[model samples]
Target: MASRGFIELLRLADMARARKNGRQGGQESDWQGIVFEIGGQRLVAPMGEVSEVLTMPEYTSMPLVQPWMLGIANIRGRLLPLTDLSQFLHVPSRLSQMSQRKVIVIDHDSVFSGILVDQVLGIEHFNRSQYRSEAIDSKSPFAPYNHGKFFKDEQDWFVFMPSLLAQDSRYIDAAI
Candidate 1:
């Protein structure tokens, strides 16, 4: 009986060791984000800031709202206001790409809404080591909500913070 108990303890120790190793390896890819195309630019939203991504859904147009506001959509029994990111940023979008728009839902703290983007390029796992925080161009509209950027695959993926966007008065005040 003592020998069997010893074996069980050894197995437990091995499992613990494996788990620790696994966690340590994951540190290299500490940051993950959902990459999407918006306004002819590739942007990435932090994984933690986005709840889910869904295809365009039917929504009722609301009168007396900003043109950027695509109105409210019924998402899983919850009303989610969909906003056109391109319109809000005043960025020009390719007309051909407009048909592939996807909704990126963000639900946190005081914000629960979906922002429409040109395309959802899937989740990207990036190492924090590749991050860059240099100041963005002064005239860039996205500069306000972009925290920094992650350089990967020979491209700069701006880390978009929907939380920051949510805090913007221009974004929240939708009434025309």
Candidate 2:
């Protein structure tokens, strides 16, 4: 009877260890990203692409610049051109000066620019298997720059590719 009880205890311990390992493995398989809102749409971007997030700063207007080009702002002594991301993508923007907004600074290659967004939702962790490489819709203004889409909490979060946007010719040419 004593030997049987010891064997049962060992089996229970093994089962507990398996459960703990399974939970940790699930977490390790998840992908992390930053979530933000732009043009009244929820979006996510890989954490690696974002350099920093800052409050909207006063900027100087440039003549003959595209309407999307808000102006130039001196951030930390660095002159960064601020652009209204929604306008650049041709999407209708619900953003207004009165509403609190933020600028997501993206630095890729030798290019650096600040993109104005509605507000940041927060950092989110998603399961890697949940990412789907499909267009959210045929009319999505951001279809070209969308890397993929992920569904979480019953909401579809489209993944925006900042690097691709930075490399686009239209984005590079700010002069009108």
Candidate 3:
């Protein structure tokens, strides 16, 4: 009876360990994103893509550049190129004052760019199952850069693929 009880105890411990591991694995599979607004549209990007968020900074205007190229701003002694994300995405530009603008800095690979946005909504956590790989309208300007979308609070949060945006020729071509 003593040996049987010891075996039962070991089995219980094993079960408990398995349950703990399962919960941790489930949590690891969850997706997280930072929500932000651009051109009055709600969008979300993977949190890992965003390096920093800051208020609009004074930037020097560049000559012979597209309207979407806002110019370069000195960020902590680093010259960061600022892009009007709304204009680049072919959306209506928000007419908010400079003080109300927000910049989302993306530092990936050799590219470092600050995306001007309307506001930073905050971080949102969602499960992998919550994502839907639906087709975006071909005519939509965001169609090429959209990864997927998630729904929350009766609103759809479109996932904007920053990496793709970084690689796009249009984004790379700052000079006219």
Candidate 4:
């Protein structure tokens, strides 16, 4: 009887370990996406796809590129197209007159694009259930890029999903 009880305890311990691993691996629905700062506003993106955050650098400008396209910057020898999040998201760029901006380079199914941001706040994980899909403002051109509304403390923020922007043909066809 004693041996049987010990085996049962070990099984319980193994089960607990598996559950912990699953939670850390983000296999649960409660996992909130990662959040970063851009233009003094908090934006959230799915944690699984964020490649890296980089500081502003010189990028080759494309002729006749769309207004939102900032240019292409070489990152670690790889030239990546950088789009200004301020213009893409339709937010004011000169709000604080940023001197040291950053880029959040994202890779979607092998396609890469560097998203320009004012600054990076950091990474954070929150439950997806906590996010509410707010109605898009009709007047804003960037409504399609917004995922929904989220709150951090008493301040409400808009969440921009980069995948939606990446899928847009304008971003893909732009030349540098």
Candidate 5:
């Protein structure tokens, strides 16, 4: 009878450890991302792609460029082109207070651009298995660069790939 009780206690302890690990993302297959609002759509940028988030910096408006191309801003001695992602995506702005807007900077490879977003909701972790690559909304302007979507909190978080945006001809050619 003592051996039986000891075995039961061991099982309970194992269960507790497993529960703790699951809560901490072990065996959770977690997918972490930087969540931000762009063009009124909530998006999750791949954690590795986003270099930094910053306040909307003052930039020098460039001449004869697409209206979405806000211009260039000097950041730490590096010139970063500021792009209004909502406008560039041809989506109406969420109309948030300008003070609340932020720039999601991407410095992948040689592509260094500051993407303006309505809001930065910080990092979030979702179950990797819940990410659906085929369920991305086709109507979203970001759909082209988006790779997948995560259903969280009853809403969809589209995965935005700014590295792909850097290679897009429409995004690269900023002439009026």
Candidate 6:
């Protein structure tokens, strides 16, 4: 009887360890990514990691700045650089009637920056398994930005890694 109880305990422990591993491995984990609107595009981000999202505000332009740099904006009295991700993604900046403009605040390695977008859609959740490795066709202008693809209905959703986007040479001031 003691041997049987020991085996049962061992099985329970094994199951517990599996559950812990799944949670820590970032798969079917409690946390999920978020999807938002940027211009005509819908972007998915790992929710809480994004600091804030606001309406497009007046910004003070910097001389000789990159085209994607929409200048600086005062947020709650703090100055933050605003980037036009649409332009950075090489997409056109024209606004349409349905466009909902907003600024997406992001942080990387404690450095904070905001992205100007044409709209703020909403959020979405998915298991990490939902994403699969895939190649972007040469015809896609978004080819360079795609990290991998997921799905929703008949549409294929592309997932862009935040670290890659944050570390883009365009966003970092090379001179500094």
lDDT per residue as tens, model 4, 1-176: 33133223433454566578674432445444446566556667765556666667687877888777877777767889888878766677644543477677788885798887776655444455557778457566557778777655665556677788788876676653
Backbone clash count, each prediction separately: 0, 0, 0, 2, 0, 4
* TM match of model 3 to true structure: 0.79
Residue 82, model 1: lDDT of: 92
Q: In model 6, which regions exceed 4 Å deviation?
A: 1-31, 94-100, 138-141, 174-176
lDDT of 4 at 150: 64
Find the candidate with the highest lDDT and give its number. Answer: 1
Pick out the ten consecutive residues of candidate 5 with the lowest summed lDDT. Answer: 2-11
Q: 2 or 4: which has the higher TM-score?
A: 2
Across 49-137, the per-residue lDDT of candidate 2 in tens digits comes to 87777778888999999999989998768899999898898777677671488787888998899899888766666787788877667
Candidate models: Cα lDDT each: 0.79, 0.77, 0.77, 0.65, 0.78, 0.62
RMSD of each: 10.9, 13.4, 13.2, 11.5, 12.2, 12.9
Better of 2 and 6 by lDDT: 2
Over the stretch 1-176, how does candidate 5's per-residue lDDT look in tens digits?
Answer: 33133223433454567677675323434776778886667888876787777778888999999999999999878899999988888888886565678888888777889899998776666786678876466876787899878887787788888889988989888997
TM-score of each: 0.81, 0.79, 0.79, 0.68, 0.79, 0.68
Q: Which pairs of residues clash in candidate 1, taking residues 3 or more apart in a chain or in different chains?
A: none
Candidate 3 lDDT over 6-78, as tens digits, reads: 2234334545665686743223437767678877777888877877777788999999999999899997788
Global lDDT of model 3: 0.77
Summing lDDT over every window of 10 consecutive residues in candidate 6, give the lowest-scoring window: 2-11
Q: In model 2, which regions exceed 4 Å deviation?
A: 1-29
Off by over 4 Å in 4: 1-29, 32-34, 37-40, 95-99
Candidate 4: C-alpha lDDT: 0.65
Candidate 1 wrong stretches, greater than 4 Å: 1-28, 96-99
How far residue 7's Cα lies from its native spot in candidate 6, in Å, is: 47
Model 5 alpha-carbon drift over 4 Å, by segment: 1-29
